[model samples]
Target: MWDIIKEIITYSLFLWIFLVLSYSNSNQGRILGCNGKSECPQRHRNSTINA
Candidate 1:
């Protein structure tokens, strides 16, 4: 019983870490249409082109 619980927790932690890493890595790309051409100036939401 304890082993099963431990396994579940371990898997959950790994999944959480993977999700967080992927989200952080792709977050900027998603915001910039995911085309991979987003630059610093265009990242601002308040900017004319971005807004």
Candidate 2:
């Protein structure tokens, strides 16, 4: 009986965590820019240009 209860509790906790992460990532827009450009503004502007 204890083992069955433990299994159910574990499954519920795993499902809850999965839902939370899925919800959080839904709002985050593209993490990487197209054309291999850095998404961060500072990194994008720091590239050195040679004359």
Give the best candidate by lDDT.
Answer: 1
Where is model 2 more than 4 Å wrong at Cα?
Answer: 28-51
Predicted structure with the largest TM-score when compared to the true one: 1
lDDT of 1 by residue, 1-51 (tens): 999999999999999999999888866656756453335534553554531
Q: Stretches of candidate 1 above 4 Å error? A: 27-29, 32-41, 44-51
Clashing pairs in 1: none
lDDT of every model, 2 decimals: 0.70, 0.66
Q: Judge candidate 1 at residue 41 and give its lDDT.
A: 39
Q: Write the per-residue lDDT of candidate 2 for residues 1-51, one digit (tens) a residue.
A: 999999999999999999999988752234433333554443445766421
